[model samples]
Target: MAEAARLLAQLIAIPSPSGAEGEILAFLEGWLRARGFPVAAFPVPGHPWPNLVVNPQPRPRLLIDVHVDTVPPQGGAGPVGPVERDGMLYGLGSADAKGGLVAVLLAVEALGAGQLADSPITLALTVDEENRGRGAEALARGCRPEMVVAVEPTGLTIGVAEAGTLELALEVRGRAAHGSVVEGGRNAIREALGLLRDLEALPVMRAEHPRIGQGAVTPLFIQGGERALVIPERCLLHLDLRWLPGIPRDRFLQEIAGVLARYPVAWEIVDLSAPFETPEEAPLVQAMARALETVGLPAIQSGMPSWTDAEPFARFGAQAVVFGPGDLSLAHTPAEHIALAEILQAARVFQHLLEAFARP
Candidate 1:
């Protein structure tokens, strides 16, 4: 537990914001190499940042997936080394995933040499999860794992499903004219606002999953007009759409198209990730439940409202679930932190799960 805290602190000290994960990746690679763990590093195509696979055994029975990158710091605050206070470890990535990463490393280290050799467990430390999930996509294309445990800050609960993600860019065009000539041109920004409002009220927003709840559409960013003096010729709006498992991607797209057709706007999907769900009866899920029970934690099952690497792993034919310590609500916030007790408990549960899965 102490070693895990030390490792968590060291990791939190490094700044690995989305596109700048090179330094942290290098540090992780060196850490694995120093411990004699067989490590494979794959650079994201066209990017210098690398995703690392440790103990890359063929047809591994279990794969532990965790991202190394974090959302850029908020309020101009950067990665300050972890600080211990009120029984918690506070830092930029502490609760989000670094805590889970530490627990995984400790659990793997706890396994006996013979067990590690026979179990064929692999750890995928991915980059770009906060952005496009490129690293996970690359791993899914390159390796095959029978089952995957995607580590996230789930407050020690097991996440059986996760919401899908869709990003759309909407461009509304109108004739540009002098601002003083109100009747001569349409304001593209004004035209886009109505469409945005309709999109926000789409029926899909009411669609619900038992655990994950209803889907949502958010207008994340918008831009228009070259200058305040001129009417805008074009208005660009970015939409972030999150959906549940049973919702078909085409249906979502068609619905969006239907709304866009109501107005004069051109739109394109910038990115999309499918939702993923694993049966509660899956062997990996059951094992994780028992491990949690063994560690004196409740075997709670729920859905992850946010998009995760689990989606890509599932698409690659691996049954995957999200599990780890810390609270999801605390992630990506200024007060981000993880309980020390949760970290210790999570390490124990992971160790137990690995040992049980390794048993013939």
Candidate 2:
């Protein structure tokens, strides 16, 4: 446990923002090689750092997905110094995922080479999770495992499902006229305000999942009116979405078009991500639940609101879930910190999970 904490501290001290994770990548490669794990680094065409694959086993029993890159520090030197206070480890990436990363390493180390050989577990450390998730997309394209667990800050809950994301940039067009005689020209900015409220009431959004709940539609930005004295001809509305899983692409777009049919707006899909939910009876969830119960923790199942690497694997029929220590709300914040005990407990949980799969 003490060693795990120490490793997390070291990881937090390094600044590995999205595309510039070179130094940390080098450090991890050497560290894994020294520990007897043969590391395979795959070069991504435009990426400065390659995805590091530890244990390189194909279609293993357990595939651990971890992201090494973090969002840039919000302020003050970028979490360069580590502070331990009140049983919590304080650092930028401490909660986002460096803690989970260290815990996975500790669990594998304790499992020993003999057990790993029998279980055939693989660990893939990806990059660019905070930006575009290109690292995960690339990894998912080349690899397929029976089950993959994304070690994120889940506060130890077994995340069984996750909502997908769809970002839309709509151009709500209107006629231009003098601001004084605005009654003749349509006010697109005013119309956009109405769409914001109407979007939440869409028919597709009425259906709610037990864990993921009803989807969310939030307006990210609204811009209209280039000049002060004239009615704006165009208004741009950027929308952020969190919709339920299993909705087909064509149907999803059709539903959006249903709402915009009345308006003179032209919109396009700006960004999109797939969603997935694992059945409760799946072996992966069962194994995790049994392991958590063995460790005297609740085997609770829930849904993640944010997108994860698991989304990419869903297309390949991989059963994936998000699980780890620390509250996700603290992720990407300047005050990110996680309890030291959670790290130790999470490592123990992971060890039990590995043991369960390693068994016949």
Candidate 3:
């Protein structure tokens, strides 16, 4: 518990925003090196920062992945206050990720302290996951793991699958005119509103997978218009759609087109992140379940609501699951925080898993 708390405090004190994670990586590399772990920093092209990759001695690597960079702090945001209330740690990045990062580190430290059998665990702490998955993508190109345990905030649940992600930018264009001559111009705001109405009415079919379960869609972000008096020339609306596995990217795009066809508005699918599903009964899942049991925690399973590096790992034919402590709901919020107890529990869980799975 003390180790987990110390590591979490060290991680949160460092400011490692999505595009800037060099200092944090350097700290982690140094920390691991002092403990006799071989560490390498994989550089990302066009970005000054690089991902930290640590490998302890032994064969048959198990990659424990966690993102180091956080969503950029808003202006006026200051250092996180470390408050211990009822055994929980209240601070920025305490729950979303830095907690998971500490958990993995402490778990490894525990193994070394106890002289337990160590299987090679590659700790890939990458950057830019909040904005994009470039770090995960870049690392995937070089390192392959027998199994990947993506340390996401899953409240300690074994997350076997995550729904797919699609980024939609709905644009509406109209002639700008004086407010007094309202009828003389086509209002882009009105067109955008109409498009939104149509989108709300569009039927997104439900999806089912053997392990990932059903899929649903939700509207997340919207932006449009500039002036109150003038008819705006343009508006943009963005939506995030979660699709189930086996749903082709083209099919998802087609559905978006079908929705926008109801209105005379310009729309495009700007980006798409493929969804992933791994069988709950797979060997990797069973191993994780057994490990959780050994730590006296129930082996609960659930589906992830957002995207992660798990999708890219699935592309490489590795059974990946999102499992860690903290409530994901706390991610990126001003009041974001996590319990120290949860961090300690996660460390124990990982320790049990790594030791038990060392042979395989």
Candidate 4:
């Protein structure tokens, strides 16, 4: 537990926000290598950032996914320095994932060579999960593990499902005309407002999942005017849509197209990530439930409120679940901190899981 906390503090002290994970990746590579673990660094194609895979033995039964990058520090603070007080560890990335990463590292270390020889485990400490998730995407493209446990701040519960993300841009076009003669000109901004209202009435927005509840549609950005004196001829609306697991991408796209067909606006999908879900009866999920019970914790199951790297792995035929310590609400906040006790407890749970899954 002390060692895990120490490593967690070290990781939090180093700022590894989204695109700038080089330093932390270098530190982890050296640290893992020095500890006698085989480390492989896969550079993210064109980017300087690299995804570090540790102890990637062939055809491993399980792969542990941990992302090193965190969201940029907000709330007027530049970067967080590690501080421990009242049995809590405070800093950026502390609750978000550094604590979970430390627990995974300690769990692997506890398994040792003898258990690992029997189990054959792989740990993928990837980069850019907070932004694009390109690191996990790359790893999934090359390797197919039997099962994956994506370590994220889940308050020590198991995430059986996660919502997918879709980003769309709606371009509303209108005829430009002088502000004095408004009768002849169609105002794109006004048209955009009407479209937005229609979107709110779409039945797809109410699509429900038992765990995560209804999906959401939110207008994130809108721009229409270039000058104050002229009627705007163009308007752009960016919409963020969250969908439930098992919803087909094409079906959702068709629904959006149906809505847009009623208007004279151009539309395009900017980004899409499929939703993920692992069956409760799967071997990995059953083993994790037992592990949590063995560690004196409830075998609770829930849905991840947001998208995670688990989606990519699940899409590529690997059964994946999200499990870790700390409250996700604390993540990316000025008061980001995790209970030291939860970190230790999570380590114990992970160790139990490793042993349970290793048994043939």
TM-score of each: 0.92, 0.91, 0.88, 0.91
| Residue-level lDDT for 80 in candidate 2 | 43
Q: Kindly give the stretch of ten consecutive residues in candidate 2 with the minimal lDDT sum.
A: 73-82
Q: What is the C-alpha lDDT of each candidate?
A: 0.86, 0.84, 0.76, 0.85
The reply for model 1, stretches above 4 Å from the true place, is 77-79, 177-184, 226-231
Q: TM-score: which candidate is best? A: 1
TM-score of candidate 3 to 2 decimals: 0.88
- Model 4 misplaced stretches (Cα beyond 4 Å): 75-79, 175-184, 226-229
Best by lDDT: 1
Task: Output the TM-score of candidate 4.
Answer: 0.91
Cα error of candidate 1 at position 29, Å = 3.1
Query: In model 3, where do residues sit more than 4 Å from their true spots?
Result: 56-61, 75-79, 113-120, 177-184, 205-221, 226-228
Clashes of each: 0, 0, 0, 0
